[model samples]
Target chain A: MADVKDVDWDAVMADSRFQSLRRKKTIFLWVLMVFSMTYYFVLPLGAAYFPHVFQIKIWGVLNVGLLFALSQFVVAWAVAFCYERRASGQFDVLAKEIVVAFHQQEPRR
Target chain B: MRASRAWSSVILCVISVLVALMPNVALADATVIGGEWRALTLTVFAAVIGLTIYVTYRSASHVKSAADFYAASGSISGLQNGWAIAGDYLSAASFLGIAGLIALNGYDGFMYSVGFLVAYVTVLLVIAEPCRNIGQYTLADILAYRNDPKLSRIFGALSVITVSTFYLTAQMVGGGVLVKTLIGIDYEVSVIAVGVLMLGYVIFGGMVATTWVQIIKATLLVIASIVLVMLVWVPYGFSLPDFMADVVGDPKVQARVAALLGDSSTVMTPSELGQRFLEPGLLYKMPVDQISLAMALVFGTAGLPHILMRFFTVHDAQQARKSVLWAMAIIGGFYVLTLILGFGAAHLVGPAAISAVDAGGNMAAPLLAQYLGGGRDSFWGNFMLAFVSAVAFATIVAVVAGLVLAAASAMAHDLYVGVLRAGRQVSSGQQVAAARVATLIVGAMAILIGIAAKGQNVAVLVGLAFAVAASANFPCILLTLYWRRANTAGMVAGMVVGTLVAVGLTLVSPNLTYPLQKIAAANKVLDAEQAKRTAIEAVLQNPWPQSESLIVKARAEQVALDKAIRLAQADIKKYEGQSRSFMGLKEPLISLKNPGVISIPAGFLAAILASLWIRDERARAKWSELYVRQNTGMGISKSVSH
Candidate 1:
């Protein structure tokens, strides 16, 4: 509800640290994407092709597909945890900075 | 020479060691598989069709303007709209899939119930108002906004096609499976019938007819589900918890429960699987599958092209929000009934009844009612299951129609009219004609996919679609709502990546290997034996020695595999006591034959990344404020034409 156009885009972009951090964030994201897909999509394929390739004997009762699918649960929890704190926080800030900058620029226009 | 080749002995020992573990063996039992009831079935189906058509025309009279045709205008009351949302949301996943999962998986089937319920929290909190507030026609209005109509058109078209194809696939499969088994209509014809019927609903009355049909069906289904649940629990005395505890405590039930809890080792041979549930595993404790299913539930509802489009029919964001909340209540109640249905199948009929009713455990609930109410031969009982099955068929048919309508709307309204024609004003007759023709075309498209996926598990494929929708659309739609930093580049990136990963996952996943029913029938005796041997060998070895010539194993190698299995089961148990848990969790698998639960958040992760990627400076500045402000001031319907 606040006037987002009144925030300072010039001051926000002037900060060089956001630029350095953005580059690191991009690299980290690509790495995250690869690992997530491997477990969620790729490993499931491997498990199907050879069901026994990845069996843990104590888990001998559980099939590889079940294990793989279940990891999604763990990953999801970890991901959600990370997101609520790290990703959500960063995005919220990023969002705030941009919205405020737009608010600031509007009065000048 | 014998001494020099000693290295071969070691190598052979290692190979044999690995080879011994390769095959899983389990016991065998006989199962009586049943078909959908025909004579009693068609009468019920005919009745539903008659009802839907009568309601269709009755509702059509309400639509008199372009606004009326496209949005169903403002005639739909909140209760009607909410019921319609329930009708739309049920899809294959809620109706056929969850029921089937319970039939097969036992208590864990409730995971879907939970996933669906919890996701609405996200929906109510994150999506409902924003979607109602931000855009119209499709997700495109929100995502593309004032920048590019072309972009909106592209994304809208893609979203519609993906959702429609997947939705249509499930409906057609449900129809074909029912028809082939029911009145013995060919599967292809069943699919065609569904496609045409759906197109007719959308083409004749557009959203108005579709909305009323959904409301009517949702009402019937919810009422039926409640009645069925109450009936199941009442016979065991009026005490619900006691009945459940009694069911849980039974040894036969407990064994199935153990198998369910056991996780990986519990793949049932065709025989052991009959009317039995495998145990639960560590997977249960972690709630991973709950996550995957939950992601599907949360993201799937939000991103559904048809469901999202339905909100446009409402006048304001508040109405849309109210509609969603009411729909959630309806959905929650329907799912609770399903929990009764699943446990009832497990509790009352045992695994035997479901194994008799349908090859997949999905039929457990219907079978539970059929068996409990009395066998199919009982005059009233004959129609109970037949009624459920017929409604199941209609449910699929309704869903497929909604999907085709959504796709058709995209092709006609956004693509043909909005994009190609631009500022040119087409006549109302022409617009109506184009929409009908597009419906026909999309209808044809649905029929084709449905036929292609004919014999496959309709529910699993629907889950696959949930994965794709969660991956591709949810991120773009949700992030654009709250995250002002989100830009066009980021939105585009997320949609593309999410879709690619989802489709890729589906291609590689176990779905392809598992749905072998449609292929030319192999000697099920040998296949069943292998399934039996695999279920057996999974545990240890054959407890039953060479038996009489009744059940035959085809290959000679199977005999050797059986011996090795006996050796391993003996060796493993002798070495490790039965008292221990693995990694402080229950065993990971209860049954290999039936996959009951999957953690579904990978799809959401795709969404999260895609949402976070927008980097363009200028676009980010303008777009951020637009999300919260636009709908608060402009109203939802105003953006529909724009």
Candidate 2:
């Protein structure tokens, strides 16, 4: 029981039920990474790069920094919602398949 | 009765609107309990749990095997582990620092919250499953999977010591600060108290008690913070703008708070001109420091030695992953609440909330509670303040206990038994005893350090630890998982170099400078006012019944001295003679150089270099033995440790 180790990558990819789930997980991961990396760039560059903060005034008052910050909250919320939705259905199905496959593996020769 | 209740609220809303529309000095002075409540809450909570953990670990420890000590026999539920992660990860700096920062700087504080959340994705996608797949007991287990026991043990021991020490110092400092604030004990006493208690807890009960205590603290803190947030947001009903408006309307409150925060104001006053030196600009100023600070949060959170160790407590990789997600959820909510709590304090209490009279208020949230809640002179109000303060202390203790355990475990289990003399098994009882002794040593060290750095930024201490972990530990672990040619030599170099560079840079970095406070202030004098004259003036005023004219002259002199001192502090001329700054390179590109202040990014470039130094091993055969053994125990990972 203690000897279990390694993944059957071939079987996981070939399995029809798991394929979409795997793809979704990959996409989700990348999306999350992009958002974060983008976040790093945003904080450093927002004041310099964005003209909205300097030039464009919304309602004759609030400028670009405030707008950009406000948008960040919305974007974060959106990403979280996306994660919860995908994780509930797509990720869950994938996890089950992976776990099931593991449990069913043949003993070592 | 219903109408009367409705009328009361309506009248209050009208009053609130009026207050927001004009500058009200009376409202600003409206009895701020100062920031004492956070300190108070911190003291109680830390005392209870710190003491409990220490006593339990020292006296009742029965850890016979490494499995018992490190994994708790893999008996903990994912949820329990999940909560413990929150308790452990949300160290004192997180609770007090993030909240206080936001109160002073607006949305920048929220940025810290997001940076923390983002790192989980990195962990979830890249590290978590692989870490679970690789080794048991510690990170060394994974890094040295293919190497000799001797090799693994060395790396493992090193990993344990470095990660545990870095994490523990942050925890101890945080605990000490909270204790000093809440209970009015000196910082030294607070540090010693925390260290002793944490050592005892780990020594007695090991993982079982640590897990339970952390989970309890996490839940309680989250609940309490959420309560405070809701009160601030919906004191009568939920209107976010109304709350902000109230904060904006009081100029005296704004001036006082703006002064206390130094250069954080969006709007500048002539009075605020002095603090402008500290106000970080968007990108170029402390750019490297800022980026490093953010990176420290993002990557450091993922690779913390103790945090990864807790993952082993769960049954499978899936459970570990689930626990991480759950922790993120709880912690995310808490961060949001912290924003509200901080703003509430700054708005309701102002800067006066923080004082020597009620030392705990430096913790921010308490200062906020007093502002939003009631009169400190009143019994019910004071009790509420005391309760919150106690809880904050407990939070610190919970965190310290976990860190102390991690460090102690390294010394006893990894260094002494595993590496020092390999193949000679130590009995569980012996292991527990060794761990207990180690705990005491670590606790003592933490107390000494914590006392030395009293009232320092809890956030910065935690950040430095994170920077070290991310630089040294993360690089090594990642390379081991993905890179096959990652010889033990390369791994060792990467880990050691990474740890040293990150730690060294952090110590010498520009962000270490606190606002407006500097070395020049310590050594120099402005105008003709000397220390002798100031002291004499004070003595003269006290001893004699001074004439009105004499009083006027003395007061004017005092005011002039204050102004001159402020002017001297504002402009510090630095002569950089052949100065190559900290990150081992000369020019820093990303720190706060202008307004809308952000940190510099020199640390990021350094970390990237540090990470790149670890080459990915390409040999597949390195994982062959493990490849065949994969499909068996609890079905976790088929991946190879590089």
Candidate 3:
């Protein structure tokens, strides 16, 4: 096991790179979660309570509920795509620095 | 290891030889495939089986260690593992069942697709990377990483076994249903066949075979869906709007919609049918049931044993995250295609035809394929039908193999190694052998359950499995990762309570209880008729009550007859359009079809409260270490070393 005492965990946790990565990831995840949850739950909740709204035809043979459900696929893919971009482009850089520092200290231990 | 490898090769050779020799006998029973494409389907199925066996044979040689058996030595690339994850996730339930649901029920079925896809957000953001970092072979590794290893492993293994068994049964039952419908085999035989094949894959080839099989099946499924969508699109001038317009105008579709709306007398217009089809309330009439279903699906995917196990197959946490994204992309695309195939079946094949084939509309996709290719007796039609059936078969095999592997790992890695051995040094060969034995046992159990559960609603079984998974496993895993004070007691309490509530609620809920009540009512009526006849015969033969007493007795008999008729009439009325409720009750006690919304929170609460009652400082202290390891993917080497 990697030595817990070899590198100061508290110092690592307080590192600026780690903190920023956590903040950005947490914010993005929360935003996507809220958005997707609202978008998803609205159909079932609306179907139960205000099903009439879903009957409102937005286009020929298309209504609010079907359109909304279809849009969710788009929304999910978007969330995944955006998360991947940020994780690889931004978060990985910070994570790699921490790993490198740990590795550099590992030989001494 | 050498002995096992040789044994696996022998098994593969026997299977291959049997497959080669058995096709002729299977083809002679041409009535099984409706006599049109029997030979073609048998050939294709044999070829598919042969290909999987070859893959298994190749993979068997690489099973020199437990790590190789469980996670393929972490050699699968992010992209390949991503496809495998999608393959593992999209069981027969999603591939054929969802499309069938959409074709029959319309807009409400699409809700399942949305919930399933949106679930990846939870997996990717919260579970995937951390789970990959902390765990080696099974999910138990992660849960046991910080707490009392034995207790945590036991609870984790129990939950894994429970979830996987439920899921495996569902997949096995689905396979039986599909084969029975497609190839006209006995349900029991079909179930046994699927069981044997899945057992062979896991026992001999392990994760290596399972992953490749999944990738192959996923690719075929996606391609088949896309081709079906295109076939559907061509009929409407390649325009979705045009297709909807055509569907709205089609007389057959309008009639089907009117019938579904329970207003055939009114003769719904084309526009009205279109509006109803696009709107909700077709299948999921109750909002609460819909909400609960959504909850179960969204959370359930995160807790599925086979799916969680896939994260370990990737090289690192980053690869795991990437794989989740790739799975989302593939799954999202497939769901979108389902929209087309579903609507196409409704428009082209018509609901009456779909219902005629299978009341639950599970045959809609295959029937659509047949229709698109040509008529049922035509070569194109038969070939398309065979291809679709082959794909569905592959889908079932892939999913069941994954489930068996997960269950086996739980038994071998968590139960035997972590608990029984008490962290003792066991050879990798011994561990691999144990996993194979566990796979065989699990596979046998699944087959027996599948045979027993023949003709039961496969969709409800799958839903209940998801509800159990969401309730029992999701809460415990989530809390274990995020909640520092979570102890062994908390984990055990949460899982046990969650499993009990989810299962208990489902058993007493309207889904099962209502149908059972109907059967009882039917039997009661028959018994009452027999008793009434016997009473008349007794009165005629003996006439026990004489004179005034006889008069009173006759009156009493008359009253009894009148009451019986009235009760029967009431039962008939009550069960005319809906299932009979318990004791002729007007409404069920618990109305939600899925118990996730209630059980999930209950589980989390149980875990938290239990932890509050019994705090563990050492576990709490380890949280920082786990957190750091989870975030940066550090210290995973130590955990993976075992």
Q: Highest DockQ: which candidate?
A: 3
Cα lDDT tens digits, model 1, B176-234, are 77645434455676676666666656766788888877877887788768778888777
For residue A49, give model 3's deviation from the true position in Å.
Answer: 2.3
For residue B75, what is the lDDT in candidate 2? 67
Summarize candidate 3's per-residue lDDT along B537-638 as a digit string, tens digits.
566567465344333333434444555565666656655676555345544678778888898888888888887898777678777777777888876655
True contacts kept of each: 0.00, 0.08, 0.75
TM-score of every model versus the real structure: 0.67, 0.73, 0.87
TM-score of chain B of 2: 0.73
Pick out the ten consecutive residues of candidate 1 chain B with the lowest summed lDDT: B24-33
Write one digit per residue (lDDT tens) for candidate 2, span B433-488: 67767777877777787777675544445565676677667766665565434545
Candidate 1 or 2, higher TM-score?
2
**In model 2, what lDDT does residue B351 have?**
35
Two-chain DockQ for each candidate model: 0.04, 0.26, 0.63
For residues A19-60, write the lDDT of model 3, one tens digit per residue. Answer: 787787678778877887787788678877887887877777
Instruction: Categorize the docking of model 3.
Output: medium
